[model samples]
Target: MKEVKIESVFQVYEGILELPEDLQELMQKAIEARQKAYAPYSKFYVGVALLLDNNEVVLGSNQENASYPSGLCAERTAIYYAGAQYPKAKILKMAITAASQLRTTLEPIPPCGACRQSISEYEIRQKSPIEMYFMGERGKVVRSYSLSNLLPLIFDKSQL
Candidate 1:
């Protein structure tokens, strides 16, 4: 048997202020969206901001429900809305952030597994990569050039 290895790489910024102007703007929008999150159960608010190929920005926040599995994550909500509203447009970038009543997580907030698969579908459909920016504690940010970096060997239609 042959053993194979995979590696993922990303950049970490000192803080949001150190990011580029556009990325900083996107992060700000994510923060604003977080304010609207309806997470009464977890009390952890998550927000996502997407930049479409048409230069339009779309925002989404986590929506929780009484049924745990019925709730939707901020990333999926934003991605679905973008897909429905701008079917022809490609998602170029996405910024994600989260806040908790307890304390600020001192690490980048990565998308859940289900969200990663959902995001991979769009990337495969658009035939391009979607840059991602994740927020961490003390304004720290993580930048990833593509979803593949986060979800490698992903299951897609190509496998079917």
Candidate 2:
């Protein structure tokens, strides 16, 4: 038998000030969006802001429901809106942030499995990588150059 290994690398930034101006703005917008999240059930508010190639910014906030499954994540909400509004525009960067009423989640918050796959689909369609910035309520952040870094061995159309 043969063994193989895969490694993922990302950068962690101390605070929002460490990010570039555009990324900093995106992070701020994400934080603002989080404030609008309707997370009465979980009280875990999440927000996402995406920067398109055309320099347009799109924002989304998590919307929860009593049924639970009816809710959509902030990442997907923003991504879908970007896709619908600017179908031809390529996504350049995305910033995600989360807050909770219970406690401060200090670590960078990553996307869920479905959101990762959704992001990967756009990456493939755009024929380029989408930089991701993940931030926590306390200001800690992590940056990834590509969705593949978070979703390695992704199941894409290429496999078919």
Local accuracy of candidate 1 as per-residue lDDT tens digits, 1-160: 9999999999999889999999999999998999999999998999999999999999999999999789999999999999999999999999999888888776789899999999999999999999999985346799999999999999999789
lDDT computed for candidate 2: 0.93
Per-residue C-alpha lDDT of model 2 across residues 7-53, encoded as one tens digit per residue: 99999999999988878999999999989999999999999999999
**Each model's TM-score, in the order given?**
0.97, 0.97
Q: What lDDT score is found at residue 31 in candidate 2?
A: 91
Model 2, residue 158: C-alpha shift (Å): 3.2
RMSD of each: 1.0, 1.0
Which pairs clash in model 1? none
lDDT of 1 at 113: 97
